[model samples]
Target: MKVLIVEDDQFHSTFVQEALVEALPEVTEIVHAANGAIGEDEARRGEIDAIVMDLQMDQRNGIEAARSIWAERPQSRILFWSNYADDAYLRGIAHIVPEDSAYGYVLKTASRARLKLALRAVLVEGQIMVDREIHRLQRRGTSLRTRLDDSEFNVLIDLALGLQDKLIAERRGMSLRTVQNRLISLYEKLGVISEFDDEVTLNKRVRALNRALVTRTINIETLETAHRDLETWLAGR
Candidate 1:
């Protein structure tokens, strides 16, 4: 089997290669791409059977590259190896991946045995394997822990980025009234409106964003993804 490794870090890429070689005897050709754009280019060549990709890269992020690749070849199998278990990354993956495609999400800190198992599960056995820690985080953040629905989370990010409701509505393709309602819900979910005193200088939107940051709900990685997505959206317009 031919496998492609899409990783920017030299040491991590080499480590993954060595692990693949050790675990899968049938993997004959293990090619490498420095970043997601190169990975997509290599994938378009049609020689690769499976891909092990890093989520964040300088040229292009794994999600965008994977979306482009899967648009052309929906059956392609991808293993996302990353250092983060951020909801933004997970949500982005869910949004783009084909319904029936085989994929895996493994943390970079996972053991070699775990990595090998994940690689085989996706490439050899055609199964999905998500890291337990990631699964736990997803569950915790989604179920009664944050109580911020996808729409609310999105509005929170927009608020954090200092976007007005009108601009957010335009960007998100939501009606202005809907954006206002979402902002109200977000303020309640983040407890910004109820928890803060009237004397607080910042408005509810700003307070909600600050609360999200303090609670570690929305983070730097999330903001980066938002920025990248905005750029992509602008380029497409």
Candidate 2:
């Protein structure tokens, strides 16, 4: 069986290559791509049987690459090897994966045995393998009570960046009152406020942001992406 490894870091790519050789005796050829853009091109060749994909890269992200790959080849098998189990990454993966695709999400910190197990499950047995922590975050993200709609999530991102209600209103093209209402909804969804709290003293916005960070709902990468987006928005305005 032929395999492809798409990772930006040389050390990690080498690690995966060595591990693949040691673990999966059936692997005959292993191809490597330095970034997601090249990985996408290589994957479209229709020669690779399975892919080991990294989440973040310079040219493109793994989700974007995988989405394009799966669009062309719906049956493509991929194993996401990432350092983050952040909600944004999980949500991106959940959004793009085909209904019947076989995939795996394993952290870089996973034990060698666990990584081998994931490889066999995805590459050989055609099964889904997700890290336990990631599975929990996925459940929470999909839960109706905890799930933030797009508008609420946007507001949360702005708030996390220390944007005021008026600024968020301007950026989102919403009335100030509407932006405030979204904040209220966001706080409720994040469990930072309650209806019975008639005499609230704590800063709801700060509390909600803190809760989100602690829960891995919004992480450093999420904020970094938001910052870039905000910069683009500001430039256009």
Candidate 3:
């Protein structure tokens, strides 16, 4: 079987390659792509049997690349290898993954054996193998009390980036009032309104961001990624 490794870091890519060589004796050809953009191009060739995808990269992120790949080839098996188990990443993956696709999410810190197991489960056995921590976060993300829908999550990202509502609406192609409404929903789900007894006195944006950070709903990495993406968007606009 052929496998593709899509990672920015050469060391991590080699590590995964070595693990795959050790674990899957049947792996015949292993292709490598240094970033998600190149990975997407390689994947679209329709030659690879499975892919090991890194979450963050320069040209594109794993979710974006994978979404495009799945759009063309829905049956492609992919193993998401990443350092982050952030809610934003999980939500992004959930939004794009095909309903019947075989996929897995394994942390880069996972043991070699565990990585091999996940690879086999996804590529060979055609099963889903999400890390236990990611599964817990996924559950929490779907829970009604804490659930942040896609719209709310987009607003949360903008809020974390310190974008004013007007700027956010312009960036997101939504009306100012719609951005504010999403923020209100975000604040409610994050319990920001209740956390601050006097809502009139507190900055809900800051409070909600604090709550999100404390809950690991969003993190420094998520913000950094969003900031980079925002810059790219602005450059194109």
Candidate 4:
């Protein structure tokens, strides 16, 4: 397998090279680049099977580089390397990521075993394998333990994201009453009282949801059910 290592720091570049050498003996060639600009230039020039790329580079960041690469060669796997999880970036990438490849985000602080798992995940399964902390934080805030109904969660997320119920109703093809009931159930789960008027209470819930999205504090077990349901619902669109 051919690997391209893209990083700004020469030390990190060398370290990653050593790791790749340790991980795979049969790697035909391991090319190194100083930044995403060079990485992009090299990638567009030849046949690189995979990429190990850093996030914050002097040139274009890894995400933009990955986008450029994937746009040109969607079959090539790109592993995102970073020190910590940036929620905005994760959410952004997750929004646009094409399915069916081991496109992953792995923290540089992760164990070598985890690093190996990420690369192997790309080489082996097409499923994405994000690092444990990302998953942990995401699962932490997801509220999976609350047993929220899929439709209920969908309504809640839409509400929290400030989507109009009328639009949601139109989109979901549900009656206004059905939308209201879903909101009621969500509000009940969130401990919101029905008597309040004005946007204060709704604002608080929306803030909470934003925090949940940032911290991954929603319980994933239940969140996954709704997430999958909504993803399916949105798929046809």
Candidate 5:
């Protein structure tokens, strides 16, 4: 499979590429771009099979690049990584690589096995692994986002990528009822409880939850410490 890395930080880009190579050496080509503008250009070329991208950049930004990729290369799988595990970026990536069709979000503090599983999922069309913390937050959201399981969260993000629920179900092996339930739960948790209305309220609630999860004002050291312990345990294997 072919892969691309679009990140501004050279050290991070190289380190991620190296780790991915060690896990999957058969990667036919691994292209690296330092900014979103170039990444968008490479994506429009339609040669890449998969992408492992960064969330932040000086120009074009990962969110905008992801939007372009979704429109141009709907077939490719994507794995988005960032130090910030905020839902804003998570939802941003969902716009390109739907949860069911080979996509994931990982925090920089994630374990090696988590990264391994994320790449493997996109490559093999199995389950995409996201940051465990992100998963917890997805479940905590009050809107259509909270009702989704990890798999559903993946599909919902994929929906943000312009996929229909029917298509997402076929890709993820889930039923339509399952999908609707997830959406209902998400809306209730997100405080947009009026299912009858699909207006600005829903959008506002979603944005609020996404912001709460991603752009936090509180200390995350406790969560960071927990992740560190988990990483130590996983790497020991």
Candidate 6:
């Protein structure tokens, strides 16, 4: 079997390769790509049987690369090895994966035995593997009461960046009132506001931003992805 490793960090790439060697003897050909862009290019060669991919990279993100790879090869088997189980990353993966295709999502901190198990499950047995922690987050993600919708998430991001409602409305193409309404909903979802009367004394928006950051709901990677998405939208418009 031909296996490809796509990771920016050399140590992690080597770690994956070593694990693959130790676990899957059928993996006779092993190739490495330092970043998602290079990984996508290698994938276009149409020779890789499976891929072990990292979530974040310096050039392009794993989700974008995986989306591109799966777009061209719907049956492609991939195991996502990431350090973070952030909802944004999980949502990104959910949005792109091909229907009914077997894949895996495991944390980099997983034990070596577990990593080997994931490799076998994805490559040999063709099964879906999701870390228990990630599974918990995914379950919470399904509950509308616990998670923010995409629109609310956008407002959260804008708020986190210190953008006022007016500027957020201009950027997101919503009316000022709509922006404020979204902010109210976001504050509620984030538990940033306790009571209506507390809005004056408590900086609800700032508190909401801090909550989002602490909960891993928003981060630098999320911001970067949003910026790229906005650029794409602008170019298309």
Tens-digit per-residue lDDT, 40-140, candidate 5: 88877848888887877776666667667867766667787888756545544554464346677887777777777677776556456676877776456
Tell me the tens digit of each residue's lDDT in model 6 across 67-97: 8899999888999989888887766777679
Each prediction's whole-model lDDT (CA): 0.83, 0.85, 0.85, 0.69, 0.63, 0.84
Score every model by TM-score.
0.83, 0.69, 0.73, 0.59, 0.57, 0.78
Error of 1 at 71 (Å): 2.0
lDDT of 2 by residue, 1-237 (tens): 989999999999999998899889999999999998999989888499999999888877788788889999888899998987677776667767999899999999888888888888998899988888666757866577878887888899999998999999999899999998998887888888873377768888889999889877777656665777788898998
- Clash count, candidate 2: 0
**After superposition, candidate 1 runs with Cα above 4 Å error:** 138-145, 157-163, 170-175, 210-237
lDDT for position 133 in model 4: 83
Clashing pairs in 6: none
- 1-237 per-residue lDDT for model 3 (tens digits): 999999999999999999999888889999999988899899888498999999988877788788889888898999998886777777767767899899999999888889999988898889988888666756765576677877788889988888899999998889999998898888888887777456368878889989898877876546765777788988998
The better-scoring model by TM-score among 3 and 5 is 3
Model 2 Cα shift for residue 84 (angstroms): 1.5
Ranking by TM-score: 1, 6, 3, 2, 4, 5
What is the C-alpha local distance difference test score of candidate 1? 0.83
Candidate 1, after superposition: displacement of residue 34 in Å?
Answer: 1.0
RMSD of each: 2.9, 5.3, 4.5, 7.2, 13.6, 3.8
Alpha carbon deviation, residue 69, candidate 4 (Å): 0.5
Candidate 2 runs further than 4 Å off: 136-183, 191-215, 219-237
Q: What lDDT would candidate 5 get against the real structure?
A: 0.63
- lDDT, model 6: 0.84
Candidate 6: 10-residue stretch with minimal lDDT: 191-200
